[model samples]
Target: MGELKLSTKIGYGMGDLAGNLLFQMTVIYLLFFYTDVLGISAMAAGIIFLIARLWDAVNDPVMGLLMDRTRSKHGKARVYLLYGSLPLGLATIAMFYAPDLPMGGKVAYAAGTYILWGMLFTLVNIPYSSLTASLTDIPQERTDLSSIRMIFMLIGVIIVSVATEPLVSSFATPSRGYFSVTAIFSLLALFFFLLCFRLTGKAASESRKKDESYKLGEIWPLLLKNRQLLIVTAASLIGNMAVFIRETSAIYYVTYNMGDSGMLPFFLGIVVLSMLAANLMIPLATKKWDKKGTYLIGSAIGVAGSVIFHFIPYDQTALIFLFGALSSFGIAAISTVGWAMIPDTIEYGELVTGKRAEGISYAVYSFSQKLATAVAGITVASVLQWSGYAANIPVQSDQTLRGILSTLTVIPVIFIVLSMGIIRLYAIDRTTYEGILLKLKEKMS
Candidate 1:
């Protein structure tokens, strides 16, 4: 195989940039938008979020099997980027738009659009992520590519986190502002998706031409036998739950506990940027310590920062940002290395089973991630409802404030700690990974 080109790496990165434009908004602002702006209760919003993601959990693997079996001029995974972008963008706009409807209508609208968005998101993201394995078989190259992809992911997060409020304020009211902001994001995301499609098309064409077919019936056993894949999936499920809980609670935490809603983008930007900075250091860290060692250290840092942030007086805004950045840095390290490990597991599966199932492997990972998000959404929403949260109220009860703080900090730390334990069960370290790749190549030859 030839050296991976820089342009291809960047184009691949743009795929995540396109994805996170919609994804970050959902994580950071979608709940807040549903409750505070659209007049839905927080609990209802949370349930809607959970239901949509649960649907995606089922839909993701189906999309993966379809992509794996698809024979197309554009390539299996890349074709979705071409066909799915417009629908995904349109669904995003629909999600943020609030029509003047009765309460029942509003609920239906939110649920319908959100579920549709999740399905469309599955169609695009599973394929895009699967493309990573198709793009290269080299482990180091996959790690480098994952870092590049995550950098763009952070850029997408930063853009939405920092710009949403200001953009909303730029419009006449919050409702109109949300529609306008989502519209802009949708268009930009569409353009980038197309760019990613083109670039990956050039790179994946040869592999797609030689790709082997698998029956739908074959995927289940392949997944069951890939113990490393299962271990990583469990870890990703819990780790992402922690991330979603923390991210979804940020708007609430800033508004009620810190009493400064305007500073949200600034703080969120700090977190994402800190994560971006950590992605830059992944290569060096992985060189010294394997992915598991690096993840252990980073998750430890994240847990410590989260615990410290939980106890700090809510008034210390500067200190809050300080610890938030520290925690985000750790989350970033865990995220980048964790995803880079997936392609390694794909090869491990092929080595064991004598069949390459990159699409199904990534699909399962996506399922775990979406399922975790569902759990997180339900958990946060339930806490808010039971804790007496009143949407759009001028003042929050002390209990509500405590609920937000606990969800934002303590709950997520517990989840991450559990995930670290799961990570310990993952058996593919550097030496194991290299051996798996070598064996797989020899078998293919």
Candidate 2:
């Protein structure tokens, strides 16, 4: 790792808004789109998302492996950003506008294109994820960079969350209008990805071997022993599951639970507000408490909100939104700082093991994220089904309604608490991290 310049870190922050907005659309709405708009059954939608995510899980590691071996004057990861953005957008559009065929046809088409999109996304993401660590060796600087990225990411998420359904609903023809609206929003997402790609250059990257290729066997042991990576990975996996549930369940909670579908934006607006608030305090939080403490505090916020949600009676929109906003604020801490930590953990990995297995470390990290998302999709879908949630039905039974409610409240709460406790066990305080960095710098020099 080289010395980090604050200006470079700020530059990277500029790239996040468009990149995240593109990612959030798929994460938040794909399931809902499949189950309701595309006319797929909820159980079937669950199975499809699970299967697709499983493919994503498998592909992430492989892409991570490939990215390490890639060579270019633009550096290892930037070229993918240059080339992958447009097709990624096209795939997004295709997924929504998939030919209206038989049920199996729709599923097959979705799986094929979505799998490709997932792989492409990984192509962009692994390098993107690995970039923070590669950019600098300083923990505080990394936190600053991460915080900036989170702000832009929130901006992106807010735009999509606030605009997507509302813009679509305004169209006179509901069904076709939805597809067109998604396509346009998706294309705009691509524009942002491209802008992000163009904005970031290889200046922050040090010259490393284009020819040096790493084997998985060597990479695995290094990741296992590189304790910081392990800590962040554990935290990231569960933290991601919590995030996935929040994203995918927003529609359900707003439409069904709150009985005010139009208020979805209002709620999502609160989420954006929380994110904005969190970002404002991030540098102070990280400087004062370090990454581990920040993570724990944020996780606790999520847990408290979830518990509050469970105990509250129906129609407490204010309370539900309040808690949801708080939970999202906590989440902003994780999102901003958590990603920064993964790359920093790579530095920790290099420090302990003398191996710059960025690709392999990031690959497994990538794999873990996909794996968590896969499990999340399966878990949520299965839970929804077991709880008797049925899509396209006019009415639901008490059991089914209770099941849906539980999915929105209890499951996320449990997942968040478990993730928080795990983060508490993470041993990367500021002093420990600085010690590691000092030793690594000594060794490299």
Best by the lDDT measure = 1
Expressed as tens digits, the lDDT of each residue in 1-445 for candidate 1 is 4458899999999999999999888878888888888998877887787677767766877788888778778888888999999999999999999989999899999999999988898899999998878888777788889999999999999999999999999888999999999999999999999999988777788552346477777888899999998988888888888888899898889988888889898989898888999999987787788788888888999999999999889899899999999988997766788788898888888878877787889899987877877787788889999999988786899999999999878899999999999999888877887787677668768
Tell me the number of clashing residue pairs for each predicted model.
Answer: 0, 0
User: Cα miss at 398, model 2 (Å)?
Assistant: 3.1
Q: State the lDDT of candidate 2 residue by residue for 394-436, as single tens digits.
A: 4566676666667666877777777777777677777777788
Provide the global lDDT of candidate 2 against the true structure: 0.72
Q: How do all models score by TM-score?
A: 0.97, 0.92
Off by more than 4 A, model 2: 1-7, 172-175, 205-212, 393-395
